[model samples]
Target: MKKTQSCPPPVRRAALYIRVSTEEQAKKGYSIPAQREDLEEYARTNGYAVAGVFVDEGKSARKRYTARSAFMEMLEKVKAGEIDVILFIKLDRWFRNIADYYEVQKILDAHNVAWKTTQEHYDTETTNGRLYINIRLSVAQDESDRDSDRIKFVFQNKVSRGEAIFGNPPLGLKVEDKHIVPDPETAPLVRELFRHYESHRSISRAVREVGEQFGRILWLDGTRRMLANPLYKGVYRDNLTYCEPLIPPEEFDRVQELLKERSIRHNQTGRIYLFSGLLVCSECGRKMAGRYATTKRKAHNWEYHLYRCPTAMQYHRCPHRKEVNEEKLEAWLLEHIQEELNAYQMQWEASASAPVRPKVDKAAILRKLEKLKQLYIDDYITLEEYQTDYQKYRGKLDAEQPKPQRPDFDRLRTCLNAEFQTGYTAMSPIQRRDFWHSIIKEIRLNTENSPQILFRV
Candidate 1:
């Protein structure tokens, strides 16, 4: 018999992941092309076959992993068993969040795939290596957080000085030397829109007329937002003169009053919904709105109050199309209010008996304060950052240490002891609305039109 020739092992396929945030791209040798070159060279030296190159430009590793398109694509390749390994220039290039790293690591581990950084040594198989990787990740995350704080501080200072931040300016405005100025072309149209809306008092009509006259289609929501924006009146944040005014302050104020007066929620229909904002649709998790319908029965007109999912009624997206009658809902609650009260009372007693005091690591806060001071001294952080962090940590340490105190449940106990139905019946419509709002956090309406109450008490 001829001896069987043994087949050689398959070559390890490597997926190269390159990422660079806008800030990191300005640094030396941190660009996407530079990272790709290094990772490809590393893969070749390790005798691994190059599978594919994935690049996510202007994306922060500190951001959610799913937000990075290339990163997610690499994960899909790994899941499909098309890639045997993932290579990057450094662990920070892969992930700055330890939790996100572990979450993706689980998928990689299941596929018998591994990751390696060309410039950083991390071995997941060894305990020490894993701990080191975690420490490095934490350090990277701290650096990212500090960078974010510094950016926010700079932006805040700019806003205080009435300087525009990086982004497209809103409608009727243009950016000039990092300052917001009126766009001569769109400013006139915006002024016309506001004046037309003020006279007509109809967003739909204003949008249609403005789009027809200016040849620019204005979205209903965007138009509403523009009408309410303080920037149109040269006010941004707390700065009253952030930009050149497109609409006068008095005109802006008048438009705001008109908006409030024309709002559907503020319309006086002489009908009060006891569970106006309390009812939630179980299907879409949107608030159920109250509406009324009139029906003629035995030559007399009767008005029926009903609660239905607004998403289903307006957008037709929710599956729950059935309307729940307010009378039936009240009856159901009256029947079960005693039971809910009893359960809440028991919960209250248990919590009161053993109050839980907040646990704070005072030592950890002190250590952070010391580290912050050291960072400031070493010029790693600016004076503003040092002062902000110092005050924040000091406030955490000096604020009145929270003491456990039992909540007063006297009102709840009284409700539980009395006939809740009788008291609920005696209450007026407005009183009933306030009462339901006070006790019930939400009333979820299921597909079967069944009411499930979530009580705050």
Candidate 2:
């Protein structure tokens, strides 16, 4: 027992992590070479055997470990117990997001691995040291948020001016002198696409025709978007562009009218339900959709069409007991609508004899144009807000300026009255559904009880 006791050598294995973002490559002391040298010297001074050197170049610390390959590989080695400690150049070089830092740090703590920064000396074994690191992480996170906001504000300011934030313009245009200008070569093709859509009033047919003739593959969505784009008419987001117009404004307006009418026709379905997209479950606040179930009665097949909460039917999230028959729902809605129509008719009759107010054609185009200029002058709103409002008002002005072909009010009134008088029996299911959609916003159904219906009018 008097002999000298021999103790095992201390574990000195360490993994060094270094990160440098794209913008930090040229910054002082943040280059890959500088970070490597500093980490190597720190390891040597501390008597640590460098097990591995993980460097994430052109990668932001704001990103998680999963997004950084080098960082993830380093974590794997730490988990394997190949490294006793992890060393980095600085706190920000380690992590910017506190949540991600805590998540990875939890794993490291479980593996009994210690982490330290060469520049910032702190004992990872102590509570006060961790508190100090957390405070620094909070500062880094706040700085990142502020930097993000500043970048956004600059981008928005540029966009508000209707100047090209990005160098590339749309297919038919090019960025010239920091503004969008029509490209002579592609502009003609854009016009031809719009003309094709206008003639056929079918996006698929237009795409097919263009693809066949031009020897270029054209998609239905691309053709549709080209037809609807206002840039062809020398306007973008309500602001007149510096580019030359590809198509006349009147032609664009006519195309829009055709598109709107076509869209309405597109939604017309043969099998129409009175309450689709209007039904909601009261229990789970989920949309109730049409469901079909079959039963056998003495060798004959019987089918039941019902509305059920999708959450309950698919996920068993709520009680699966709530359901309503389609026929019963339609009957209840028809009865309710009849009462509303009667009240509406009475109100119309009472107001019929009142003096008719002279309709004024509000020159909204001129008014909105002036208001837009005034908004810029007064600085009442940001340039982005002003531009958004200007575009909206200009659209409204254009739509309103064109006086509608006056119809005989008495005849129109008579037709509406006839439709109202016809009631549910005389109308098609599609027509009834459309009528309900126009007036009723939603219908909430509870388990085996009367539904709560909300009407807009």
**Tens digits of per-residue lDDT for model 1, 124-189:** 888998898899999999888888877865675587577998578778999988899999888889
Error of 1 at 158 (Å): 1.5
Relative to the unseen true structure, what is the Cα RMSD of model 2? Answer: 10.9
Clashing pairs in 2: none
* C-alpha TM-score for every candidate: 0.56, 0.47
Worst 10 residues of 1 by lDDT: 258-267
lDDT of 1 at 377: 58
Q: How well is each residue in 204-321 modelled by candidate 2, as lDDT tens digits? A: 7678887787677887777778788787787765345534677887778767875764522233434455676778788888777776677999999987568888888789888856
Taken over the whole model, the C-alpha lDDT of each candidate is 0.81, 0.73
